[model samples]
Target chain A: MQLKPGGIAATIGALAAGLVALPAAAQQQQQDAPSVAPGNAYDQSASDVDALVADSAVLYYQEDGGRVRAVEAETGLAWTGADGLAVSGRFTYDSLTGATPNGATRARYDQDFIGPLPAGGHLPAADTRTGASGAYTAPAGTLPVDPHFKDQRKAGDLGLTLPARAGFRLSLGGNASWESDYTSWSWRVGLAKDLFDKNTTLSLGYNYEHDESKPITGIPMPLGSMGDPAIGKQRIKRVDSLVLGITQVLTPAWLVQFNWSTGNSRGYHTDPYKLVTLTDRDSGDPFFYVYESRPRRRIRNSLFLASKLALGSYVTDATARWYHDSWGITAWTFGLSEHLPAGRSAYVEPLVRYYHQSKADFFRNYLLLDEPTPTYVSADSRLGAFGAWTFGLKGGVHLSDRVELYGSAQRYVQNGKRFYRDAPGTMAKVDLFAGSRSTSLVAGLRYHLR
Target chain B: MSVDRRLALLALTAGTLALAACAHDGAAPHLKLGARPWERDVLARKSMQLAVEPALLAFDDHTYFSKEAAAGGRGFDGGGCGCN
Candidate 1:
């Protein structure tokens, strides 16, 4: 269900109430549920010994309507030195293929979507990464889908943690990623300290990111005609972020975390390949398509609170988040999960998360020929107000004393709220809120050895 | 940084500092503090980690970036990937 303007506050209130009752719930569960705690071995940190936690997973995501399928594989290893120094590294590879919906909506007449000419291709190049030329024709009354959307990415990360003092720790991290049309390099540093016998922890972190984008068809001017000459070959964007995290153990069986993060992104923020169609006022026929435009700078902030309660052999987790940005968008997210031990060596977890977002300042379904051009405008559905839910189940088994294997399946559904009341021509009659249905599956193994 | 971001960052710093000071002053005391060394056994379970599934969490962050318009509430995410 969509949340009203004041609904975010209500959600926060409910979360606070849940937080207040967690201890009570824990006491009740402990009394009724059989204690399944393993004979007295505590967290790895309790023992001053070198330790390692390594894991690997592969995920497959598919969206219906023959649009946007992805395969992502990741592996990571974290090592904790007996003397309090930690080191970690990770690698990820992602492959995305299949068609994706263009911002343009369906019309009564067939529409031919063309691309920029390639180095050796014919007049219209349909796919940029592949350097292929062909016009994708959207059949009359069908939503436009760009069948040539494809890309692969490789990314790596490294981190280090040092014990600066008796109760303070410092961390440093870096990341690099490469794609056909984009690349990014980022770094971060954080400092944390433990208080109250390590029962409470506070951390502060800062991240800096730099990105370069070279659109497949060459970068174009914002809101410029698709037939216009290319404006440049590449653009740059930079984002600076600050994060504060607080983790407090409310009781022996419960812990709560609060985090506040803010980020500012400046520079080119437009999606060069995405376009908005301007339809004829009467026929609803496509008159022209132009690149969508967005503000160059964005400042964002969020407040997050999460609580985990361990009751006997079961665990319950609840989380809430409120977010806002300079572009006149606000969002709220709530998540709940329960873990039940199935047997001596296995368990299953079910989780549900709901998200709601308000529209951006300049979001529009489509532009009209007669209407004057606004300073900023976009047809990207991602900027529109919408609600989404994710339902998932995960099961895991301990293969041995130090080996575990797990898998999970999840489904995501999104529905755009009807935010606009007027549109020219048949555009007003078309169903513009065609939210996506996607499912993902993950399988992985983890091993622990000292 | 933009002026708004600068102000926000300043506020984050002030908030962090305030919380840290409150904790340093022994505001909670041992009685109200969390698990003791002996009580740590149950709380130490892997399931109790803030992120029970780090891999899944990472995957979701990337997946949702394309579909949603919100980010930054859990932890620091080093930016990577050209999200469609």
Candidate 2:
């Protein structure tokens, strides 16, 4: 049964009372009862890792209309040491191949790479070293992409948790990732405390991340004229974040959590490989292409709330979140999942999610050459106003008390307007949602070793 | 409204919601012996845990971060890709 808003309020009140009243009605006080621990580094959980666990997963993703395809595999290991200390490590590898939009309009003629190919070129394109080397030479009236585009990445993570005095837990985590032209490192620390007989957990966390990128053609000059100077050095970006969260057990079968996070990032935010086309104001004909530019600094904040409700053998998980950034973009996300038992050792879960976002103030699909140039402009579809929905199903089989197998499949679709603004001129029409549909499949296994 | 103003308003609204969700009666509800334990039993199951699938969930987070414009809410902010 779902709890009505009023009923939830009443239940919350009861929980407050239960904290102080020390509910003697608790029949078993099951040791396995879920703790009000912060679930992640941002949300600290108070419980100690008690077992050695290993998990592995493989994921396959394909975007509709052949936009992008990716395959990924990940593994994780966690073990508890003496004195309530836990250590964990994870590794992941991702291989992505296929075409991604170049933010350029369909060309009226087949355009060759702007420059010549490099010796021992890895890709098939003749213009291997040029900015367009790997780019697809679009046929007239077709979107351009580098059909031979490919990228691979590998990442590793390590974490440690230490239980301190007075029911406080401290956690530290670090990560490093490497790709052909990009490298990143990050670290985080968090502290969590349990109060009111573990009914409530409060946590505070901080994170820092550093990234370096040296694209195939180096850093393109934003909005630069043809033959502009390029920065051949790697670009750096950094982010700092702080989060505050709380998890509460509202009742024997109800759990709720809330988190608030603020983040600040500095350095180049532009996409080196992505460019937007300039169209003639009168004819809407493509003229030239220039790389996008964004503000050097960004500040973002988000609020998240999640709840879990148990009904007999079934449980429902729900989450809602709101996010905003300095770029004048706002977003809302909602998700729900229901878990039901199919047999003694098997269970199935169905999930649904919805997301909506407002466009950035400077978002543009294509620039009109006659119009005044903006200091910041991006034709990236991700920054445009859009709505997306995802639906999926997941199931798991407990092969034994020590081993479990799980798998999931999900489909996502996004919808948005193709044109950024209504201009009186006849513009080249494009299908903004051409790459909107994607399917993701995941298979995983978890093993617990005592 | 300006971005700063919108941010302030959102922060205020979020604060209000948190307070409301946590609102409780000043007095604790005293429980007598022997209330039903079925609900507790269900909640104690591993499947009922909020983070039941750690590895898969982490993978999902990365996938969305790469594809979406918004990121960061639950916690760790490790940079993985240049364009992401």
Candidate 3:
């Protein structure tokens, strides 16, 4: 069932009551509380105490059923005339499919560094790092394939501020992903500078990535005669990217941001794990085959814009993005979000996003068996053009001064244009391929300590 | 050339600038150090300090970005298995 606006309101009311009751409980047990410094306790107002408590204890959790799960914890401590520091970290686990035979499982870890701006010290910058790994088994009865596939990825980044005279900050990062026979590595560095006395921020960045894989041997061909295969074949690919952007604060409550990026890729871009089939000219029968090798080059550009508005008691945010690539693909995305207070301490946000993309340059329905072909024919679904829409609802409830509960659910649907194929002469028949529409639900709770 | 000396010099410069700025701004009346009006009641409420921002977004994006093979979310695009 869908959660209507009234239901959201009721949930918020309950959260508000829960938040307000905590102070009452603490007051009832005040006699048991620890002693406070004589003048320090009275020097600060009640609101200062509340702010201190809120800033010290913060936790977050989210779970997407059978797809993803995550938890985060953070704590901050502030002293008079000294910089405030907050330490936070997150962990996530995801299982793409149900406990099916071909399901995949992935896990990730992240840490963030946050600190207050030094006196006139510009905005505080943060650093983050994440590592992930996953393994998946091919679906049953699909093709003669290996039992399973495994991969691991790790990334690290640093965000730092530059001197006001330099008018820029720098962000540097590196990443690596490896499998049994393949490895990918990437590095990126970016700079951002504010102008017009913080009214506008401009950023520029560059990135380079490389991938190398060792070809597998000793596999029996499905259609062709088996032969003693040559092993130790190596494949390599490289990608380079440059991005530029600017953000402007139109007003105290309004902002606009724009970004443009260009990317160039070269080398072996074909997937060795997937293949396509073509019907024979003489027999008119389909034969499954694999691509030997193919090298490709691609260029891509993307732009994104976002704005946020505050209305009386609610905040509204909107974002739009466009992307174009030399592979003959163009795509657009739009998103909207609204956050409303449920009660004194809790709030709920509803979000929706829509995305659409055009087809690739070499995407094909099928290939004729008799036709002389290029070096590659792939059925990788991501290369196809498609459109998808998602609707989601999430609620956040504060259970105590340092604890929170939250849950969210989303429904997604995709047009069956690129992935789903329609056989000739079948008006109502459609083939549901490996990629299809799906739905997810998530919920989790978190607690923090000072 | 020693690391300690370099750090000491850096600290001296930073301290000098900080002290100078504080001296110039110290004469100004202290803005009451407390939560803003909108934050006053919210902070007093329990769960106001709960951490939920990045974790929720990270999980949701991870699931869909990998499963649907869509792009965006938490930077770095394309790396894992192309199963989606």
Candidate 2 per-residue lDDT, tens place, B28-82, comes to 2442111134434444556657787776677677767776777877764444676
| Per-model TM-score on C-alpha atoms | 0.85, 0.82, 0.59
| Backbone clashes in model 2 | 9
Per-model DockQ: 0.47, 0.26, 0.05
Largest DockQ belongs to which candidate? Answer: 1
Best-to-worst order by DockQ is: 1, 2, 3
lDDT of 3 by residue, A138-190 (tens): 33223222222222223222223222345556655555554444566777777
The alpha-carbon RMSD values of the candidates against the true structure, listed in the order shown, are 9.3, 11.8, 15.9
- CAPRI level of candidate 2: acceptable
DockQ of 3: 0.05
Model 1 ranges with Cα > 4 A deviation:
A1-49, A117-122, A126-134, A418-421, B1-31
Model 2 agreement with the true structure over A1-450: per-residue lDDT tens digits: 111457434534543443322212121221233222322111222243578989887777778777677777889898987688889999988777667777676545664333112224334233332223353466766666656556778899999988677799999999899877789898999999875555567889998999888776657677764334465557888989888887777777787888888888998788876776787887767777777888898888888898888776677999998888899999998999998765345567899999888988988878888787789988787888889898998766555446656777789888876553454254545443323578887777778786
Evaluated at residue A89, the lDDT of candidate 3 is: 25
How far in Å is the alpha carbon of B18 misplaced in model 1?
Answer: 7.8
Ranking by TM-score: 1, 2, 3
| Worst 10 contiguous positions by lDDT, candidate 3 chain A | A100-109
